[model samples]
Structure formats: structure tokens, C-alpha cells
Target chain A: MDKLGVAEGLINRRKLLGLASGAAAAGIGLALPELVMAAPFEGLVERARQAGERQVVVAGGTGAYGDLVKKHFYLPFTEATGIEVVPTGGGYGEKLAKLKAMTSVGKVEWDVITLSIDSLTPDVTSLLRDLGDCAGLPDVASQGVDGSCLREGVMFDIGGGVLAFDKRSFPEGQAQPAGWADFWNVKAFPGPRALPNIGNPWWALIAALEADGVSRDALFPLDIDRAFRKLDEIKPHVTVWWKSGDQSQQIFRTGEVVMAMLFSGRAFRLRGEGIPLGISWNGAPLDAAFWAVTKAAQHPNAALALLDFIYTRPKAHAEFAAESFGSTAQRGALDFLTADAKASSVLQPANWSNIVRVDREWLAANREKVLQRWSMWIAS
Target chain B: MRAKPLAGSPFGGRPTSAQEYGPGLSLLLVTPLVLLLVGGFLYPVGKLFWGSVFVPEATFANYARILQEPLFLLVLCRTFEIAFVVTALALLLGYPVAMAMARVSGRTAMLIAACVLIPLWTSVLVRSYAWIVLLQRNGVVNNALIETGLTGTPLRLLYTQGAVIAAMTQVLLPFMILPIYSVVRNIPDDFVRAARNLGAGSLQAFFRVTLPLSLPGVTAGVLITFILSLGFYITPALVGGPGTLMMSTLIGQQTTELLDWPFAGALAAVLLAATLLLVIVFRRALALNKGFKLG
Candidate 1:
């Protein structure tokens, strides 16, 4: 009887495993349509050949950004012009140094680069091609003319740093923190907090001052020393200094900390995942992630076309925005957003209005000094 | 003309070119390895060390900056202190476990050995996450503690220095154990028997006869654990608070966030120098120990 019972159990276990395998196979089968749809874009290679353009290498295109560039830019460009996008992502300084190093060695590999203001601000004038030359191109000029996108490189997305909190950790009917000031306030709320482990301590410092009753406009002529003092007070309370957006979400989900400073879209993703995360847009600093053609690009025209395509395709912009939790530079891009995407994203005008427009040029120039002081201050 | 063929009677075989070509052959065999070491490791390290001082016009500014800042010294001291404590803990825990494994017979010993290695094989990140789950307020350890009436509340175990030490020790203990195990296994039974014949107690025999013989392995384990602990980033980052941030993480932030390669390289050079110095000192001390010479 025992032997028979064991055999029955074995048969049931096998059936369960078989069911799991079948489901996995079905998942692969479901993805086949998307693969088939993307297949036609391969014609871009022949088009590129006909146009006499060689392969183009797209640097810093490895992450989701890289994936997007490949799908929307590389594949289409290859079909249209025959150039290939090579994806490479590393630390911004390291990547720039590598590019610089390659140029010095006369072995430049990347044809295009997608960089943020933080990356392109300092030496970008030298590293990047003057897309200004391509200003006559309608799509390029249109996308590139947006307030944050700037005069040179085209802005692809409006990303920012926002305060994210776990709603469940806070009491019901209590006022949610509306900004950085409230994020640093511990006594009233009383829980562990996490902060960004990187970047300007300036934001948190500003938040601390605001918590102490300083206004937003007073941030400049920055009581740099006073900000450090303010940060020092709150430093002990931070449980985890999160390194990445994903780490921030994980911290929230695991209840590692009640609140955190996070990338704007991560909070949206957490809410989608059913975590009770709330984004407080008040005093959120807006940052821009822009794309530019590398000086060494072999297919600058196709790269321009890729940029134009992104600007012109409202649907694609909308889809990217919906997935990434940021907004497109195109004015009417929000019309395509789903209700769920709009409700959670920081892209809405109301949220965008609350964000302080950061002076990227000033920030970039003084960033090194600010960071050194911040690191020293944090350790102290 | 033969001149006794240069008296090649050292071996029965005829004189071969290999005998005369020993140095050249050795150089040929070692050249690739040396080139690899120089190109892959030395060049980067040399560049870092040089850049630290040279970037600001051959100034000692980087070194001076480190000295002038109390935070750097404090972190460096704390890092060494933590590494020392971790090394002591690893030796304490690992020595007995290794001894037990060496003494025990059959499948159970192999199973325990496998269990130790299993954790080593698993991703450090995965283990750290598991630790977070286990150590959280509502997690298994606290729940068990509460249920057993050990405490009225769950102790905060996830983000303390204790947590960092505990996690670090767990991760580093295997490195300490394997070397000691190899040494302990070779300890002849007759030595202990001989001690017993001299009317020494079992504890005495262990302390005098057995212990000193195991010093080489213990020394090796200490070196491994100490050096490994110095470079620890992930464990402390996951299980520790702001105060627990180490030199490596600080260097990482410098590169990724500040985009300050020169400073990052400087910090790395400092850490590398400190570790190398410690290892050298440790080797000299070990060499002076008389038992090690025979062992």
C-alpha cells in the first residue's frame, strides 16, 4: 500500500512539472508574434547599404534605454540605411574616459551616444557632434527645441528625482509628505528613511533646510555649510542609502525603510506592482536624459533619422513613457497613455509643475566640488 | 676532440640541448604569464598610484587631502578594526568546525563539508537577501524569538554593525576553515599519544602538542579572512546602515556618482597599499615563529 501511495505521488509530481513546462513553452509561443513583427525592420540593413552607409555603433545603449534605441532606432535605421547599433553601458565617467581614450588611440568604436545632462555637460562640446548642423531637419529641430532638450542634443525623456513613501507605513488619513522637507521630517512620522547613495547631497541638503523652514528660492547662494549641517542631523536616521532605482523599490517593498528618495518612474512601477508607494512631487527636481550623435559616428544621417523618428512617432513616445514612467518631449504624447499609466506617472503637468527646473550647466560645473564636500560631510 | 663530452655522467641519458637551454626555456615559459601580470594588473595599478599624485601637477595633494580629512582616517581605521574583528570571529567559529570535520567519519562529514561549500557556491547577493528576510523585524528569527518569549519586541537585527559582522563572518568562515582542515588532518595521532605518555591531560596535549602544529594554517586563514573582509562591499551595503559604509563603496560612489576617477583611483591605491603592508608584516611575523620553519 505504501509503495502504491509513493507511485501515485510520483505521478502527480511529474504531472505538475509537465504543466509548468507547458506553461513556459506557451509563454515563448506568445512572444513569437512580437519577434515576427520586429523581423521586417531587418530590411533597414539593405536600405543602409543602398545608401552607402556602413555600420554605426551606438554606445551606452545596453540597458532599457539601449533596448529602446535598438528596437526603435537600430532596427529601423538598419532597414533604412544598413548601419548597426552596438550597445555599451558603463559608469558615465568611465564611459566618457573610454571614448576619450579610444579617440586618443584612433580606435573610436561608437557612432552615437545617449547621454543625460549630467554626462554631456562638461566635455560634451568636444565629445558630441553639433546636431545644430542638422537643425534644418524638421523632426530634429522639433524634438530638440523643447525647453529642457536644449539647443544641441535632443531630449528624449523628462526624468526626475522624487520623494517616494510606502503608504502602508504611514497612518491612514494622515497628510502625505508633499516634498523633500517632509521626507527629512522624522519626529511626526517616525520610521526609518532611505536616501540616494549617490549624486549631489545638495538635494537632501535643500530638503533638510526646507524641513527646517527654509524656502526653495533660498537654496541658491546655497548656505552650503548650513546645508551640510542640516544633512548631518538627519544622516543617522537613514537606514539604507539606496544605490539604484531598483534597489529603492526593493527597499520599499521589503519595508526596509518607510520612505526614500527615488527616481520618479520607480515609484510608479512600485505602485503598478501593487506596493502602496506614493510619489510627492512638491519640490521634486526635474532632470533631463538626452541623446546625441558621437563625433565618430559613421552613419550620422541615419542617427539623425532615428532621432527624428522618435520625435515624430507619438505612439512610440507614449508607449516608452507608459513603460518608463517619464514623459516625451512631444506635446501631445500623453493622449496615448493608459489610465493606469497616467494616474501613477510623474509626467502629468500637475506633477511636472511642482518640480524645480534645475540649472544643469551650473550643477555640472560645480558637481565635483559638491560631491567631494558631500562625501566628506556624510562620513563626518 | 671529445674531451669526455664535458663529463655528462650525471644522468645515463645522452647530453641534450634542454640541459644547456634551461634558463631560456624557463624564460619562454614564464614570459607570457609575466606579460599578462604586467599588462592586466600592474599597468592599471601603476596608473592609479601615479595619477593620485600626478593629476594636480606632481603634488602630494591627494595624499595630503586624505591626511587632512579625519573622515578618511576614521573610515580607514574602522575598516581595519572591522576586518580584525571579523578575522577573529572567523577563526573562532571555523577552527572547531574544521576540526570536527577532520575528526568525523563517513557521509555526515562530507555532508557538512558540502553544506559549507554550498553557501560559498551560491551568489553573495542571494545570500545577503536571504539574510535580510531572516533578520527583519517580522522575519523568521524575530518571530521565533518572540514566540519563545525571549524578548517582548523584535530586536533590530537587519541594519546594525552586529548584522554586518555576522553576515561577513558567515561568508568568510569557509576560507578560514579549509586551510586549517588540511593542516589538522596531517597532525599524526602519535603526537597526542606521545603527550599522553608524558602524563599530560588531553587539553594539555591539544594546547601544547596539537595547537602549535596548526599555526601555519591558522595564520593563512587569518590572512585570507582579513584581506577578504577589507574589500567587502555588498554584504555591508545590504545589511548595514550609513555608518557601515566601507572604503570600496566610497570608491565606487566616487567613480559612478562624482565621476571622480582620480580620487577613486587614489582611494583604491590607499586600500591596496594598506592590505599589502598588512600581509607583508603578517608574513614576517609568521616567518619568525620557529614551529613554522619545521612545518
Candidate 2:
């Protein structure tokens, strides 16, 4: 237990960052826009109360994002309705594993889960109830951004792995890193760099291919060899191949590497600390995590009610995303954000265009092959 | 003085084999551990291997895939290589500390023991992160070197193969020390005195009489350390560079990332077999006689 606490404390710094942004979100999130369809959400709450579903158990990641979501969505939902919100979850990998294990045992424990875009992939998609055009969630269908409502789940959060650097190294007037190409340009950007060595090699691979001259839109069915070749040039210069998101920020803080590829949310968190960080959303992979109701959810009614509440309350969604440096699929979420929060969020109109869209079908099909090649190439 | 008593049965008095306790009592004594081993370890491992070969139907495709990909073999060899380095380093460093602990009386022995045991209590992640602080670009090691005019710039000390070996050795040193210390403590001073009385110098007494007797401990220590080192995942992943990939990391990617349990099981089965094979070879090679039966 002592060791577990130590491990959590070390890793929870990422969550701590989320908490910081949550506070910032709270500071300016006082002005939530009025909703015309507030009555519908109230009726759903009444229905949840009538159904005797007093609580919805949610499995999601912890830390600031967890804290912010609970504060902005879960806690408010609980207040508006009589239903209590119980939060439990782990990292994406652990969540997926738990889902697989629970479903296999025929004793699923969670009413809802926050999952990755890969949840929509074959095999995992079966664990989810096909919300079928999400016909039941009318507010979500009308207000969620295009493509947010999928057959398997709704996109709840969005962030991307973007190229981030210390602005001190490349002062504003001087040449600063603009994109993945600049991240590769060691001559112009003469400093130690960092890239992910975590299992999500596709981010680095995609960035490498982009740097190697592939256009962002056409980068799927990746040119793995070319990516490796480009990676080779930067290998000697890489000071850190960070494992966890927390470690990435720690390395930057310690001046281990002046520039590195970091999650956009994490980078914004660093920027929030006034660390003079610069982010380039250019050519970054558009990463998204989804929220889905388990097929065997004990409180399906409550879960549906909670989902509708999230979409209809755009201000809370905005604050949750703003403080967490993430993006929500709620269409009205943007209007509630401060300009600073908007600039930090990847879902912003200007930043959205620069993010390289992951071909989820290709990634799902080739995850094993891509990962094997990545491990081999990196080690060699 | 009466001859020093043999470091006899752990159960006290004369040594008696389990059969003397009778089957029922012995079974009762072992039931909990046996149940735990079977339930926690064997069942899951058995299920994993079952799921692996039977991907809906029995096939060796997972095993075949391991052979087809050079990464598995390469990582497997590298894992053994790192384990060997860590084990050797731990032995070289641990032997002296263990000898000191054995020779020292009362408070001194307690103090030395604390030095070895305190680290075991700390989490491995904390220790590895400590290494990061000491070896990073602007970390203590590099800062010290620069201040001392050893180098003009900071050396890349963190995230190298060297860092992995160093951190792992530090984490595992206690395992190497305790076994050797236990064995050395039991050896009578008379053994060394006997060698000295026979006209041997201290060095000769240590080498011929002491070291040979200590081989049982050395073998035991090496076996434990080597096997433990083989499966090391977190330390290398956190402190070692991507180039410092190991077999466990490969297995992890399969299970967590790829969700290809069968392939992960195959990789694990291969590693387990290799580890068992190595352990057997080591025991046979050491050939400790009598009570120190390695087999």
C-alpha cells in the first residue's frame, strides 16, 4: 500500500495538472450560457428518479480530468437529479482490460465507461450497446459536433500529441518550431529533443511520416520504413523517450530536453504553469477518448440521462475541457470558454484544421503490426 | 568448548522430513500455500496458455509468429544479457557487504543489515526516478562532473543501457547479499582458523576454505537475482532508453496494447522456458554437494 501510494503520487502529478486547469476553468466558468431545452434534461432527471436508479457507476481515468468532470458534470447532475455519481477507473489500457474481463465473466460492474476511439474498433465494440444513431439521446444528436455520435459511443474528450518546445530556446522573434518538420530540423532547432517511447508509437510514426513529406490527410496505411528513417536522424539527438505524461513534464521542467512531442493538454498544462512553453498543433494526431454505456450496465436509464445532461450543459462541458485542456464533442461548448482556454484546447477551430486525423480503421487493423515494428525499430 | 552446533533444522531439534509429520498434518501445513499457488499463479497461467494456443482452435501460430519476428529473439537475448550484467554486478558488490555484515557483531551487523534492507522496503519506481534525478542532463551526476571540470558538457547518463544496469543492480543488491550473509554467518571461525593453523595466509584461508564453502550461497544468490532480473519491466521502461527493450516489455505490449493474449502468452512461455533452462544449467554447473543440493 505504501508503494502503491508512492507510485500513484508520482503518476498523479498528471492529474494534479488537470486539477490546476480545473481551477482555472472554474475561475472563468461562472458565465454558463442559458439552455432553451433545459426542460427536457429536467424530465430525464425525473425519469431517472422514477426508475429507482439512484446512482450511476462510471469507470473513467482519475486526476484533474476526473476531478473536473465530476465537478462540472457528475456533481451537478447529481444535484439536479437525486442520483449519486460513483467514479471508478484507471488508464485506457486497464479500463479496456476490465471491460473484457467483466464481460467475459458475465458480471459487468460499471454503468458507463470513458474509453478511447479504439473502443469503436472490432471486438471491443461488441462490449458496448450500439446507441444506434443514438436515437434515444435526441439532445446529443442535435447538438453534438459532426461525427461525435457514433454507433458504439459518443466522443467525450479530444486532445492530440503536439510538438512542444521551450520558447526561451527559440525566442518569439527568432525562429521557433512550427510543426513536426521543425521538430526534425535539428540544424535549425539545435537542441536535445524528446519523443514518446510509450506503446502509442503511431503518434511518433505519424509525425515522422509528416516530417518525411507526407501530407497530413493522406498519411494513413503509414509508410513505416520512411518513418523509421526519419526517426533515425533524431535518435542521436533525443535526450528522453518519456514513458508517462507526468515524466514528460518533469523532463521539460528539468531542462532535460528543450523540445519534445507532448500531449496537447499536458503541454497546455505546462504553459499554464507559466513555463514559457510553445505548442504547434500542426501535423499532430487527433486523439479522442469516448464515453460508452456497457452492454450489461446495471443503470442504463441513469447512464442515458447522464449522457444527455453532459451534451445539454455546454457550459460545464466547456469548463471541464477548458480546465482539463481537453475538448468536448458538445457543439455549444466553445461559446462558454475563455479566449485563453480556447487557444489551449485542440478543438478550437484554428487548431482543429492542423491536427492529423487518425484513420481508426487502419489503426485498429494494424495496431499489432505497427506496435511490433515500432518496438523493433526503436530497440534496434 | 563443546563443538559448535550445526545450523540444524528450521523446525528445531533433530531434522525430520515431511513424511515424519504424516500426510494429513503435512497437507494441513501446506494447504494454504498450495491453494494460493494453484489458484493465483497456476490457474491464471494455465488459462493464459490455454487461450494462447487455442485461439478458438488449437494452433501454434502464436509460437510460429515469435520465431518469424526477430524482435522477440533479439529482446530475449538482450533480457538475458541485462540480467546477467545485473546479477554479476550485484554479486561483485554484494559479496563484500555481505562479508562485512557476517563479520560485524551486534549493532554493526544491524546497521549493515539496515543499509541492505531499507532499499527493499522502498518502491522500485521511486529508486528508478531517483536515478533520473541523479543522471539527467542537468542532474546531480552531470552537474558534479561539470563543476569538477571533468567534462565541458553534461554526459547523457540517464536512459542509457548503463543506467538500466546501474539502477537494476542497486534495486536487486539485497537479494544477492542476504543469502551469502546467511551462509557465511553459519560457517565456524574454526574453519578459517583451521586453514590458518595449517600455515595458510589469510588470503589463502579465505580462497580455499571460505570461498568454496560459500559457493552454495553464491549459487543461490545468483539464481534468485538472475531470474528476478529476467522479468524486470518497470525499471528498464522508466530509466532505460527505448533501445534497452526487454522480453517483458514485449509481452506487455501484446497483452495491454495489442490485446493479443495468445501472442503474449507465447512470448511469456518462451521466456519462462528459457529461464528454467538457464536455471537448470546453472545448478548443474555449480554442482554444490550434499546439503546444498541445487537440484
Candidate 3:
């Protein structure tokens, strides 16, 4: 048996050697220099043209905000122009990376990209076309927001990070915990908690400070270490550190935690799901996502047009927001929103009023410093 | 030279005639597979190595930065530490299971094998989530422990090193068991019986005859589990604490969050090199075991 096994091993080794040599030869034969394939992207664009169909690849078209993009932007625009919309999911940084990659290689993937204020309003100035300078658009400065709003991107919705809790868990009709200070009071609320794990320590820090009795208005030039220390105090009490919006909702829905700091849409969804969740609008961080035209868009005109058309129809915009739990950029859209939804919705004008608009300029200028600090905080 | 050799042989034997050319022909046939492996696996690995050394615009900045960062060093060390613990635990858990499967009779052994593989067959994410349910503060395990007066306070199990090690071992045990089971199942009972006949007790027979022979299987299992454990990202990330920053997670953050491609690539290159070195060491160790059959 040993001799036979030895013979078999020797045969297998010899066979392996033969296979290796043949594979090497094949490799040499097939190393025909790849002519940097551009055909797939080009083919999709060409097929759309040949079919007499306008093509639009809309980034950030996966979640509720994305669903709004589908219903309001793509569905209506496609009906108007006989175009097909390719929906893709990517946040601002991902979209920027992709846009940069495409422009570097000269193969544009999307006609339009959605970017949040935190990502788009900075470093992406060169990659975006000047939408404020575009003809027949609302001059944002005239409307009192500024050139910062009008310069490159169009804000389609007002979204923010908010505090939410399971109402069933605290149903004594107790004095409502107004802000982050109350959130930190474990003795009063006394249940497991959940917090975001975005790697951006801004919200976490902000919540920590708020919990430690720092007023919202006094939160500028944020003392990060103090905030971290406060978080350290509360860290053991937090049951789940959620990574995604959906994960936040799952934590809440499963009753895994009684209270959580959640994204607005996720909070809205939980409320809609009859999970006895309440959204506290106090000290919410307002960050708006903007629609921008990519520098390398094949249909730049169409992309801009789509962006404009989304803000034009007030009734449709309201309907979109109502369904999506997101408020539209249109001024009159809130009037069309139902009283019950407007009361509970963070997207409402009243809700938006309390939201502290994050100065992206400050964040953008200090992106590296902030991110490094943030990373330190998270791992620490 | 030996043209007149065999008078009674089926075919008259000359040296050239006796040396069949089939083996040489077979060697010629398998050259393509070699080329494929070289081109596919080796080429990419070569590229990664080159990327590590020759930073874009030609600088060793990435490597220098990696060395300078205490976090990077710490994480890398932790990754290996986690991998070692996971590998040890898997081996400890898997050996008995594999032995039982090897020693037990037909359907029962098969059923045990199925149970071993059921976790492997499940999605890794699903398994990690299941662990989350099992290890959470109010989870089943905690509830049972509390009810049984094991502890008054709910022991914090979720997002801990222990949880990560446990989950990782559960995930990787099948890899260890399957290879060991194959080797153990084939080991003839005669060796053990012979040992017993030589005045050795049952335990002595197992130690002398069975254990030495089963080293090949155990070596294979350990090597596989170690390698798998090193690259594990999702399981560790989901089930582990903040301090459990593994190499893959760091690579992910560098590429995805930090957008530092060169740094990410360099880290990846380091991981690949480490993996290769460990595998080679394992192979050499196995080769030195002259008593065990290589196959």
C-alpha cells in the first residue's frame, strides 16, 4: 500500500508539473495586451441612442431619497423624454471617486450624481458644472441662501440626523426628553441604546456634548476630546452601534434597543412601521444632499434639466416627499403635505427650522483633520 | 546498449523499450494548467508585490507611513492574535468531532458530518447575525446564564474578543474537521491493534499509532483555519469590539473611506506576503514528517 501510494504521489507530481508548463505556455499566448476596454460603457450608450431612448444613470437612487428620485425625477422625465433611468446606489464620496475614475479614463458612467453637502459642497467644484450660472434657474442668492447653494449643486431635499426613541418603552406620559442631554440620562430612560457608527464622529461628538450639557449654539469649534469622554461615560450603555440606516431601523424594530440616534428617513420608516417610535427634532443636524451634473456626463443638458424639473412641480414634489418621508426643495411643497405627516415629519418647514444646518465649508476645509480625529475617536 | 535483455518476458526488453514515454507525454500535456496558474495567481501576486515596493511616482511613502502608524502595527498584531486564537479553538473543537465521525458507523457519522457543514453552508452574514442574537446582552445565552444564577449582571458578550473568537471558530471548524476526518477515516485499525498486541493500552495505542499518523490531517486543518481566519473581515467586524481592528478592516477603510488606494494596496501586499510565508512554513513542516504519507 505504501509503495502504491508513493507511485501515485509521484504520478500526481509529474502530472502537476506538466499542467504547470502547459498553463505557462497558455499564459504567454494569452497575454495579448488588453486595449483598455471602453466598449461596455460605450455600447450601453449606443444601444440607448439606437433604440431612440435617452439614458440617465442616477446615483443615490436606491433608498427612500432614491425612490423619490425614481418617482419624481426618472419616471416623469422618462415619460416626458422617452428615456430610461439606470439607478445606482453610492454616497457622495463613492460617487466622487467614480466620477474621478471615469474622467481620468474618459469613460463617463453616469449622467447625474447625487452628493451630500458634506462631500459635494467641497473639493468637487472642478468636477461639477456651475448650475447657478446655468440659464433660466432660480438665483439662490436672490432667494437668500447664496452662491454656495447655486454655484454647482441643487438641493432637492432637506434631511438631517435626529434623535428617536421607542414610545412604548417610555409610556408613562413622562416629561418628553427634548434633546441629547435627556438621551444620556440612563437613570431616567434606563434602557439599552443605539448610536450611529458612521466613522464621522461629528454626530457622535455632538450628541456627547449635548448629553454633557453643552448647548447646541455653543457647539462650534467643537471640543472633540470632551465629547469623546462624555461618550466614554455613555458607551457601556449603548447596546448596538449601527453602521447603516437600515441597521438602525432593524435595531429599533427588533426592540434590541429602546432609544437610538437615527437617520431621518429611517426614523420616519420606523414610525410608519407602527413601532411606537418618536422623533425628537431638537438639536438635529441638518445636512442636505444635492443633485449635481458630472463634468463628463454624456447628457449634461438632460441631467441639469432633470434637476430643474424636480424642483418645478410643487404638487409632485410634495407627493414625492410624502411618500418618501423627505421634504422637497420647493417652497410651496409643504402646503400640500398632510397635517399629520407635516406634524410628525422632520422634513416639514417647522422641523427644518429647529435643525442646525452644518457648515460644510468648515467641514470641507478641515476634512483631513476632522476625519483623522474622527477615526481616532471611533477606534479609541 | 541492453538490446538483448529478456528471454522469458512478455515483450523482449531493451532499456529504451522498457522506459515507457507515456509519462513524458503526460508531462507535455499538463503544461497549460501550469501556465494558467502562473499567469492568473502568480502574475497578480507579482503585481501586488511590485506595487508595494514601487509606490506611484516612485516613493516608499506608503510603506514608511504604515511603519510609522502605531494603529496599523497594533491592528496587524491583533489580526494575527485573533487568527491564532480562532485557529486553536477550531482545532480543539474540531478534532473530537472529526474523530467521532471517523470512528462512528455509517448514518450517524454522515449526520454528524452534515451538522458540521450546516454552519458552513449558511451565509456568513446570517451566521454572524445569529451570533449577534446569541451573544447580545439580552440574548438567549445571557438570559439562560442569568436565569441559572451564573451572574447577576448580563455579561457583555456582544462586540467582544471572546464573541469574535467564538463566532470565527464556529465558522471555520468545518474546514478543520473535513480534512482531518478524511485522513482519520482512512487510517487502518491494524496499526492500533498491532500497538495493543505489543502490550500497549488503548490510550497508548491511540497515542503511538493513531496520533502520529493523524498529524498530516491536523497540520492541513490548522494551516487552512489559520489562513482563513487571517483574511476574515465581516465576522470580526460585526461580532468584534472596536479594538478588534483587523488588517482587512483597515484595508477596507483605507480604500473605501479614506480613498487611499496606494496605502490600501501596500497593506494588501503585506497581508499576501504574510499568508504566503505562513503557508510555505506549513508546507515545509509537513514535508519534514517522513512517517506520514504526503498524499
List candidate 3 stretches off by more than 4 Å: A1-67, A73-113, A126-151, A292-313, A347-350, B1-23, B136-139, B143-155, B276-295
lDDT, candidates in the order shown: 0.71, 0.82, 0.73
Q: Is candidate 1 or candidate 2 better by DockQ?
A: 2
Provide the lDDT at B78 for model 3: 82
Candidate 2 lDDT, A208-245, residue by residue in tens: 89888897767988887888898888889997888889
Q: Tell me how each candidate scores on DockQ against the true complex.
A: 0.25, 0.54, 0.16
- What value of lDDT does candidate 2 attain over all alpha carbons? 0.82
Error of 1 at A41 (Å): 25
Error of 1 at A237 (Å): 2.5
Docking class of 2: medium
Going through the candidates in order, the fraction of native interface contacts each one reproduces equals 0.36, 0.75, 0.18
Steric overlap count per candidate: 10, 1, 15
lDDT of model 3, residue B278: 79
Models 1 onward score TM values of: 0.74, 0.77, 0.77
Clashing pairs in 2: A21-A323
Ranking by DockQ: 2, 1, 3
What lDDT tens digits, residue by residue, belong to model 2 across residues B1-295?
A: 4233366322345446563688889989999999999999999999888888997689999999888888878888899999999999999999999899999889998899999999999999899999988999999999999999999988988889999999999999999999998888877888899989999999988878778778878998999999999999999988888789888887887887667898899889989999999999888877745444222
lDDT of candidate 1 over A62-167, digit per residue (tens): 6776676566545544443334555677655667778788777876777666666666665665877776654434554544323534545677667677888888
Off by over 4 Å in 1: A1-63, A66-113, A120-149, A291-316, B1-59, B121-126, B136-138, B146-155, B250-269, B280-295
- Of 1 and 3, the candidate ranking higher by TM-score: 3
TM-score value, chain A, candidate 3? 0.73
